[model samples]
Target chain A: MDLGSINPILLVASIMVSATPILLAAIGEMVVEKSGVLNLGVEGMMITGAVVGFAVAVNTGSPVLGFAAAALASAVLSLSFGVLTQVFLSNQVATGLGLTLVGLGLSALIGKPYEGMKSPTLPKLDIPLLGDLPVLGRMLFSHDIMVYLSLALVAAVWAFLKFTRAGLILRAVGESHDAAHALGYKVVRIRLMAIFFGGACAGLGGAYLSLVRVPQWTEGMTAGAGWIALAIVVFASWRAGRVLIGAYLFGGVTVLQLNLQAAGARVPVELLSTSPYLITILVLVLISARGIHGAPACLGRPFHASS
Target chain B: MIRLEKRPQPSQLWTVLTPVLAVLLTMLVGGIMFAFLGTDPLEAIRTIFWDPLFNPQFAGFTRPQLLVKAGPLILIAIGLSIGFRAGIWNIGAEGQYIMGAICGAGAGLAFYPADSVLIFPLMILCGALGGFAWAMIPALLKVRFGTNEILVSLMLVYVAENLLASVASNLLRNPEGMGFPGSRNFKQWPAAHNAELISGTGMHWGVAFAFIAVILAYVLMSRHIQGFNIRLTGEAPRAARFAGVNPARIVILCLGISGALAGMAGLFEVTGPAGQISIDFNSGYGFTAIIVAFLGRLHPVGILLAGLLMALTYIGGELAQLMLGVPGAAIQLFQGMLLFFLLATDVFTNFRLSLGRKEPA
Candidate 1:
């Protein structure tokens, strides 16, 4: 009930850090969906990245290498998903669910040795003058490399989808794979590449969690952040710019709730823990009528050239 | 280059064969995973696939647990299969299950120290209504705003879990007992206890309901007009509209029925095997039932058999974990493999693979 107790400066800083992961994942998934592929295995991919990132960071003592390894590992896992959904002509829904289960189990199994292992912290990039700015510095310029990278990735994707010929082809394939195929675009190839990029971004998000957010390895660590990312894509209406807003909004909710809990506010723990999700759902319900109009026409539908 | 040619009709042979093939492949692949972990591959596989049912040392004890385990699985999967057939995916059955337990158990606990026979039935009704109401949120949203049910349902699971933890730790914590994070043990209460109908056979009220559900589903799917609408809607949405099937009505009906059934399953589970509302009561039956629905090809009879098979793995997987030192996560991986392989092999049901095919330009 009391908003007075919350520190806006620290709150904004925390939101930036927390939003980075969801932003990375959502932005990645946005590209994949733009290419006309829907992969529900974002949660699984993120968790794999989390564990691999944590394990590698703990072993090699470098968060950068850990992030790289996490991305590579999840890309491999997502490749299996791409193969099953694309090459084998399986139902995308069922295949994506299976991928999540596999990712969770595989991450848990792989991380068994690294249980309770501390992750090497990701270093924050501090611009000499920008980082010293009065109010904006702490909120924007003072974050780990991943936060800036996440913003950069969003801008890059926005530019790619808007200005580049490849982006046009990706959007075309998403609009109608048949037409794209008729236009001599390798629909499956474009989709697979998008899927790979999506996987790598999701991995980066997971790595950010393990290396920077919590700075440790824990089972089930991602804790539905990947799902929030999925919802954000829809909330963003598949636009790269809106995706940033959606992630930040969600991240703000999460941090605000935690701050409420920490400030000894009388709000029950259950409501606080689940408020972010409930708020996201509420937002989804509000905008849903207008939301899905921008979704890729062939988003969840599998492509088959022979058909 | 390889190509997939659509068959005029789905192959009947592969429908029944895919689950079996998937199981065999899981064993083969899972065994390799176990070997990499340095366990004896054959022993691990045998332990997971064979020992619990056929091994004399474990069968007497594990056999009775199969129904106990499969009862809720079958109940939930039957509901899921119904919705899935109508192409309305209610992925958050887990949340429904937890809510059902809370409402049913909460109602019973309110009447503690009373011995009325009507209490149990009333609790059952409350349980069903609780789940139905929870599920209706997503159903109505989809019908009204065109929101995706899958994401909404899935998000509700985390909400439900938090609610569960809160209830156990604060709201429903046993007052008489020394500050514990669970409700009063319903199994020990005479009026609310879900006692087994046939002693030593695992024929509790839940198991009986599961059997009745299977029979009811079979009849409805085979003889009912509503069932036809559901099947038609799933297979051909446009054709169903032409045939006078109402999509919104179907969505409500399917979600309501599935939610009610899942609620009953949770109610029965809390009262019987689980004994009370605890912080970590849910064991992923809601999620696992999805695999069962798919593994059974979304058929009633197939779901019944698939439920039993999945239950066998649950019991056997624990046995493998205890005896062979196979990690718990491996069993989950194996279950996931079942769904993946099932979907992979199911491609053959609707299409034929051809080699070096060139399309006529």
Candidate 2:
């Protein structure tokens, strides 16, 4: 039994890549939840984005345009959710679930034609000095633009939540919508914006998968990545930095398991592959020990004017 | 005359009728969807809802499969309904189901070729305990740390899948079989086999247990003090607290029951219909059960019927896949449509759909 079989370098790099989608989606959902709405439709939104992004990229031959189209499509889909839950005051749990179902069906419908069609490859934007650096280059710099974007988005989101007035207001609403409402802030409008932002982010995450990761559209391709993103948000405890940590950790576990399987480890390939999910649950159990940090007070509750 | 009013309180009539109305509305919307997809709407509806049960051409084979399919669904849904009623969402039943099957199968296969009577009962216990233990993680987090059970439990499903895959390939691999990524055949092993009681009927003890679960659940929910406590917590938390109903206790109980039942369903499935453990052993039954629980309005009988109806679509949808050139995804989307449309139209049950005069904007 060669215990030293795990290649730590390539292992970490693959983990980062694997973690990218979950990170992107979790960050997006974090913003959404921070703005005082719980969208369980992340998986739906992500999958919808996955197929649509793949389709648009394949047709237009621009990965950038494909990502944009994906975000716009998902954002549009999420707008319907906003109208139903935010405007109509329906049950958030049920409506969000409904949105997922609808998104899934809609994606399947659209993706039928695009199935098996390879997406235009996203080029790795190598950083000059950084990407050229020996071992770390492959581990960090030599990756597609979406990978960098996910990292930047995390930083940008962190700063926005901490310093910006709009972020403050969003936080206020999440903490207590009634307080935000009394302070002359429009809760519904703020929430709607947040919902769209989250949806777009989730869409981008999905697009990253189809456009970059898997490079093809398949039915149910997101494969619960969206749900994992949702969990990462909770695991992150609603903080941007922690979200990065959680996502990467989950990704590392997933990639390591896959690598181990590829290395021809004596262990069953299935068990090794599933290690990430198990590790995610274990991490969630641990992170949940402290309760989630910065969780919005009014999260998952539909804010009614009369109530 | 006791007239139905939009009561200041929640309407009981609406509670009883919403699931039925949701089904009808789903049919209507699904019919439109079928038409949009270039299939005859009425025929699609018939195939989805009717053919599996009544059509002489298909019912012979399809009828028994309905119970086989519905058994796990009803089991999983019933467990989910309990947590839902308590506002403790366990969306990771799929993970729990996978774990149950893995653990149960693993336990049974541990004694391979040694035909002891203890194998079947031990598997059942392992299956239930496996699910119960898996469910306990989320429940414990929610109770002890104020963690979001929805997220924790859901993420765990993926973890459970990974475990199932690993076990199937490594520890549980059949020695004689040529490099297959699956466990030893439990059906052939009499002590572990969950075979049909009445031949060709497809009815197994699991189906019997599901019925028993419905009765047991109905009694617990309607007759017992704990049931009242669960309803109270779901309906009016403040009132429940005032009534001395322990919130933490209810969470534990609800999650435990749900997890155990989900596990039992998984155990039965692996032992009977599924035949062996593999990477694709779990069929999203836990997630679908969430839809089933809601579709059934969280009532036991409603869940039973809803389970059966959902099963019909599974069989019919498979038929459509074989007969028409319709992709498997289209059928999945068709199933998902039931939940989406049901939820969308459920708005009517709560809020009256009436055209309003324009407000002075």
Return the top candidate by DockQ. Answer: 1
Model 1 lDDT per residue over A1-307, tens place: 6778787898999999989999999999999999888899999999999999988888899889999999998888888888888888788888888888888888888888888777779777878999999999987888888888899999999999999998999999999999999999998888889889999999999999988998777888998999899999999999999999999999999998899888878889899999987987898898897646698999889888866
Please state the error at residue B197 of candidate 2 in Å. Answer: 3.0
User: Model 2 scores what on Cα lDDT?
Assistant: 0.84
Candidate 1 iRMS, in Å? 1.1
Q: Quote the lDDT for A137 in model 2.
A: 88
Q: Is the docking of candidate 2 incorrect, acceptable, medium or high quality?
A: acceptable
The weakest ten consecutive residues by lDDT in model 1 chain B span B352-361
**Candidate 1 lDDT for residue A212:** 92
Q: Which candidate number maximizes TM-score?
A: 1
Evaluated at residue B277, the lDDT of candidate 1 is: 96
Write candidate 2's Cα lDDT for B208-242 as tens digits.
Answer: 88999999999999999999999999989999999
State how far residue B279 of model 1 sits from its true place (Å): 0.4
Q: lDDT tens digits, residues B1-361, model 1?
A: 8778888899999888989999999889988999999999999988877898889987888888899989999999999899999989998999999999998999989999799999999889988888888899899999999898888988998999999999998888899769989999997898999988888777788888888999999888878999989999998999999999999999999999889888889999999999999998889899899999999899999999999999988988999999988899888888888998898899899888889857686
